[model samples]
Target: MWGRRPARGTIVKICGLRTIDALEASIEAGADLAGFVFFEKSPRHLTLDAARALVARAAGRIGMVALTVDADDERLAAIIAAIQPDFLQFHGHEAPERVREAKARFKLPVIKAIGVGGREDLVAAKAYAEADMILYDAKPSPGAARPGGMGRAFDWGLLNEAPREKPWLLSGGLSPETVAEAVRITGAPGVDVSSGVESAPGQKDPSRIAAFLHAARGAAGGEAR
Candidate 1:
């Protein structure tokens, strides 16, 4: 997976995909990455068998990401054997040491999702030195059903001066209407969307997916494919 270096454009990841239509739409839209949620509470959560089937369809066409929330090694091992994702996204409260350990044990790249609200959160994300990439998403509301995919957004200005120590993605509350502005404001090299392109929670719309990719690419100064 590391061998397929990102192309010369802003990386776009459409997360929480669950169907052949959504998977095919992502690939057809030239998305750099496709994400699958594995957290049980998430509406977009997928069974190992289902994820494996989607991964088989996506073979070599796009990067597959397995997203989890504080999963233990047994769970992680099971996911690795089944989905064979190119990257593991730790969207929970896994410490830097845990992130490092997972990379060592699994022999795969890791993407650590940091809940961002202010400058301090950005500073703390640097601790994940071993993470191949970092994803900055909005912090969930109190007692929210899930940590992410809530469709809330933080101030894009918060990342205007963020240090470029690691590759990062801007997420949260982005839609086809706003992704261009987000990319312009944050100057993020990558952007990720889940609920933004969905017709509803857990339901992806191909037209919206295409529109988002178009906007994101234009904002990144690349012509839309």
Candidate 2:
């Protein structure tokens, strides 16, 4: 399993991509995963055609992840039909049972996002032990429509108290500059990034993507630089 041991290299992810150029940048930069948002409310959301095109362009050179927020079976089925992503990331209020159901239905590995605001939120990961991976992201502020990519960071120290049963990715407000510290503080096996590689909302800056990946790799004691 991916989470059984400490990941030697930080699993860099360049997410919220909507263009072929951006996807290519992520692959060329050696990102471990490329993400496409499916929520209509997100500025980064992609149309079915666009998502399929991006997935096709990737051509299995890198792992592809589909990001969805509280989607029902019908919507998930539609997205799965279109992209057939290598991994499914749930960034919503989905219970562990829902995560299990999605995993069984899609037969794809599930990466559940656990929003961390305080020590209490760490408990949520317990319900998702069966998930293929866990993503520890900063909790979105109250009333925020989205569950993640709010560009806010939480206390990395809180993660020290989390039991290391399952592999987890540290996310939220991670950038080229802060990723090393985030890794050092949390000792996370993997890491995920979305807005940190973007020049603006919904716009991926290829240079920033490369820089973030390089930094994350260096932080993980790799030669990505």
**Top-scoring candidate (lDDT):** 1
Q: 1-225 in candidate 1: lDDT tens per residue?
A: 322225556789999999999999999998989999999999999999999889989989999999999999999999999989899999998999999999999999999988887788888787888888888999877677778638888988998766577788889989899999998898888899999999988999999999999999888877557
How high a TM-score does candidate 2 get?
A: 0.95
Cα RMSD, each candidate: 2.0, 1.5
lDDT of 2 by residue, 77-125 (tens): 9998999888889999989999989988889898899889999998888
Please give the range of 10 consecutive residues that has the lowest summed lDDT in model 1.
1-10
lDDT of each: 0.89, 0.85
What TM-score does model 1 achieve against the real structure?
A: 0.95
Cα lDDT, model 2, residue 117 = 90
Q: Which stretches of candidate 1 lie over 4 Å from their true place?
A: 1-8
**What is candidate 2's local distance difference test score?**
0.85
